[model samples]
Target: MNVALVTGGPGAATVGPCTAAPSPDLHYRLPSAFNDASSKNGRAMPIDLDEVPSRGSQCASAGKRRSWIPGAAFLAVLFGSIALAQSPPGTPPPASAPADLRQSKGVLLADRPDDTLLLAVEAFDDGSIGLVVSSLAPRCRVPEDVFDLPVQVDRAGFQLKHVIRQQQPQPDGACAESIATVYQAEHYWPLKTATAVTLHLPWGAVPLNEAGLAYLKSITPARPPPALPDDAATYSGLLDQLTELLAAGRNQEARAAAEKVLPYFVQRPPDEGGRFFGILGTARRRTSDLSLAAASFEVGIRLLEIAGDTHSLGVVSDNLATVRRLQKRLPEAEAASDRAIAAFESLDTPGGKASLGGAYNNRSLILWDQGSPELALVYNEKALALLKVAYRDDPQALRPFLEDNKFLRKAIKTP
Candidate 1:
């Protein structure tokens, strides 16, 4: 059995140190029941990853699903054809496909043989997640490579560069020097973990050959995705996809997707109230779904402790508080702001400090709305103080999140 750990999202997967140890059942793929699975602090580790096929297995088991992976042979065919540019005419392509085709890799779920090698496992506040064939290549690159000439830099930019520097390929790493191909690093990552890790290829392209696809498909089956909230604000999948789309510059599509998914929260769907409200709130606010947005954010905050991310509860609380403050809902907003501020301030990481300060700035908005400009001033002062002491010297480290001059004004306006 093999597992690969990956993280990104609003909540932190770093919450529990329960043990990276996989259960014995997970150590090897058994036909039926998995062994003693451990749930850290009561929340099962989203220990998502895939188990590669054991080399010693009989040839039959290595390529066929019932023979090996339940539906792998099917995936092998699709990806095989795709890898060789053999797609039949009229295959659907996502909007970013043509321009980004050579760089994209994704899993295909065709009905022919039925087995698949791709699975998306998400753990909130950590990172969006997915799995795919090891041989699949990635099209995404580090952001700084946009210049026609080498980007000019000095000590300051280099210092700021370390924030996400480790993500770049290193001299000794397995990936090739060229940005166009990623075969080397994929071969080098340890895909064998006790728990199964899912593979997440790009949407328009397949990265491997039939043999490689078939081999990866033979690895393992995914546990079904967890129950999703009916409301739009808190829907993990929608938000994750939206964020990815936004980053990829497919904004029009993301806006449409958000509009389709987030409204269920506005009316409070009976079957899934709290969950729906949260996702709806997030969708509304972020996608300009403002009127009912604050209400949705509040519901999400209320559902936090029961949800996978305790940290996001804090984030939503702050988010809802901001919307409420914007709309003149003073009392509820103030209480929410207090909770949000306290939550971020309690943690020690640089992220925690920055988020905590953001909470303060958000709180000031509420105070100003509540007819207490004086208190608002105090909170603004606090936000500026934190930013200066902890982030100003290397503010560029904030990158795409806070690089705009308009955003920088927060620090100067605090006084």
Candidate 2:
């Protein structure tokens, strides 16, 4: 249901190819049978990371390399710059709770001239809870690392410490922007009778009041369909076949199938045609046909715009920017990125915001290629901020963007 977008690697930076993960708000429903098959095959089946081409690489060399790593290990490597102290996984809570509860709160726990801490908490339906603490320090101090360590836990609640490390202040008395570092930790304790949580900082204990325990209780979770509807079976089957072909690394076969089906969808409806064109474009791009990919994305963009599908329009436009960048057409790439950013900006939804972040990331690369590192850094920071907001619940998904920001900053600061 999720689509991967290639938004990384401009002209000749050392950074490798980067991809944006699917936002939760942007998903298409496929038949349950097709979903089952995709799951069994160990593929999301739409656009896997391995299918994206690396920038500055020859077209013939596209899709020739694959790097697969475990999710936990990948996260560890991604956040290695930030300190993380993980507690041992706790045992499951007993099954005698009266009712499920979910709540979240963000409170400013400490405010001082040197340091500030904002604490956020979330309690899940299963009696488990998570805490995120953000520490802000003056950039001149060079706050190097931040982490959280669990101190104690029981039915009465839990205790933890927020640790911050910084270097000596710069002698010039010059100051830059404030640096914010985040630390997260989760606990499996049953909180049925818990009253409050305490954070043990270097200064004192900051007790966080849990006044709104029922804030998230009224929210409903989505349930999956029991079976694939008969009316969508045929179309779903065809789409599944194409996705499976791509999943199996048969790019040529997938491209052929997409070409065979593109016309029929194009005649049916604007939305359908737009989606299929995106598929066709992805297929062609995977096969190293940059011109055909750009052409397909153009058609898709027009169709999506006609259908008033701003989300898909943004996606297609972003993909076109990638194609143009790969072709070394900086102006065209920047134009496409602008269109994509505008499309996403018009939408106020979370998916739109995340896609907008992706568009900015693409534009940053193009600017970097055009020898505008300062402007590139600006756009990159914007992308990071938007992406962090959208992916707050799934911080691991921000790995690529985080890496890009790190490398871009290093590049900007290097002589």
Candidate 3:
């Protein structure tokens, strides 16, 4: 049995007007733990590639309740810059792997310079292929058309699949200097299918080994491209429905809906998988299923890393701390919260402060549980101060913090 000291408040979504307004999916408003939902309006926020990712959270009193972190669903064209002239279906005959691709160390393409190019091939499940020419230096520039020579891919000594020269910036920020030139290869390779192939770059020929084949297979295949609704409102309406379901305590339903809509997000710039996993993690945590909840958040972290969404990554990290705390892993929870605070504090964006506040509040709980009431009070006060900035638009959003302040104020005075 659960002691419902304070009821949870609602989550917001940004859906189209097509659907009926959703019920108040109020997040729990207590002092026990903090809720870090990514959106403020109780709906999903738009995923802006230009903006760093940030999420929203609500807090509740001293009791077990769901941590609601709302994330906005975004739909955008994946690899819009590259025009993939769809490849023909059918796996090419397999041949022995080549030695060049098998080199433990990536062969450098450029001469003695600050930057070097490590050539690699990335093939996705959707049959979209790209030759990634990654620049080794952190701040280096690669040529706009890096692969001008006649590139070749042969399966069992057969060549001549149509290749394009659509050079584009690497989506992942970790490799800020990397560039990709997409290719439409024949047939999609499943995860772990080792095939003999060669990349005929102008600098030299880079052959792939069976291990290289497996490496390409291991790369997180981009989600299959989604056929975005012709009407933005329809998409919005769909997002709204998802939010309402999650807010209404329909955890399983929300997870199912997120999975169903996932494939369509493939090829998009933002890591939609990260956002969806975050949503699923929240729903699972609410149900007190800690193992599954942690798994979901872990996956979200990976996807965000792949997407290079620093802001969203911070938001997810903050939310993970709350989940770890609920699982009674105080040390892990504290570490996660600290990491989240660091990430958020690095951002100058509007959403960063609120995220930082939520992390501080979460860390406060861990400290309080560890008998550090004084430190807890300090963090609690910090949360209140920062959250005030985050929820300025909606005074109602700050209700839980106000309650926390009242409680912490008294608790600090007790000693």
Candidate 4:
């Protein structure tokens, strides 16, 4: 599922601990997709989040299993960027629909300006061009108070206006939120090529269309990625347990369980393998450890390749791109986002649709860093719309946490 919510502390509150020290109640239900119970040490102890060592370094290795796959969860806050996925080569040509998209009329699909990575853009006979902006982060303009000792309403309003302008919006509907959604839908793109380019005004609605997001409503049954080949039933059961622990904010316990499930990860089906690695990688990042997180994603990507899963690989690539961004390797970061976007565009599964959010998230970050927060708002909204669909069933399942509301508001208002 897709993911965030702000006011960022532990991201979620916990009544107690979530440890593998004890078996979860037999009749106890857990959070949807995330906290994995099976990943715990064989003891199945009821190690709740409250019981785990809160002071333990989030990065401290928890004795990983030799057979474990790469990951358990992701922290939406670690690095400050999002993504933009490009359409893949050999896909059906697009038709005019939204201003956000255009055909590649005369322009060539060159490699990313910073990275030497060869791009896979498909130029159409039509002249309209489609450029894949990469490496997105979804932070509202840095909160005014984070800088000044005191808060200024006037300054806040100014920053808010700046954020709104980037969305380029016109309100619709009676409800502000609904109106914002419709306004954003104006910028929505649905696998189509468009003509309009330059925006005369800085303000416009980011795309958050009802139709474009229809796919999001169709949440897949809490199933693992189809490619995962291990004991699907087993991994599925374990994943559910882990999610419960996470939802309740049991980071340490969740981490422990993640390790126990590692061995089954390598040969388990592709979707599951990549997904596991992606989760584990995220868990590492939540603790502020970038190197291991990057390694986890790399391992996940390798597993997905073997599973013949182009879509999951794209997701892993996005994960890798974000990790690179944290390492300050802008060039590599951009290329990874590009590849992730390309991979998603080339796929036909729901994962492809959901993965677009990650691309937009990464791309938004890149724009924000370039002194273009205005543009970043538009892309951030796009990712928000996608995440709404993806995480409708399960939002708070990951660690490090995401600012779902902050980003959602950012999506609606752009400023």
Q: Which regions of candidate 2 fall more than 4 Å away from where they truly are?
A: 1-233, 240-250, 393-395
Shift of residue 88 alpha carbon in model 1, Å: 54
Candidate 2, residue 68: lDDT: 14
The backbone clash count of each candidate, in order, is 41, 0, 45, 94
For model 4, the superposed segments whose C-alpha errors exceed 4 Å read 1-230, 267-269, 348-351, 370-415
Better of 2 and 4 by TM-score: 2
Q: Quick one: ranking by TM-score, best first? A: 2, 3, 4, 1
Q: For every model shown, what is its TM-score relative to the native structure?
A: 0.35, 0.45, 0.44, 0.38
Give the number of the best model, judged by lDDT: 2
Best first by lDDT, ranked: 2, 3, 4, 1
lDDT of 4 by residue, 277-302 (tens): 66665554554545545656666665
RMSD (Å) per prediction: 20.8, 23.7, 19.0, 23.8
Per-candidate Cα lDDT values, in order, are 0.37, 0.51, 0.46, 0.39
- Residues 232-338, candidate 1, lDDT per residue (tens digit)? 44444434555555456543454345333332222233223344444445544544434435544544554454443444556677777766555556797788788
Error of 4 at 175 (Å): 64
Cα error, candidate 2, residue 91 (Å): 85
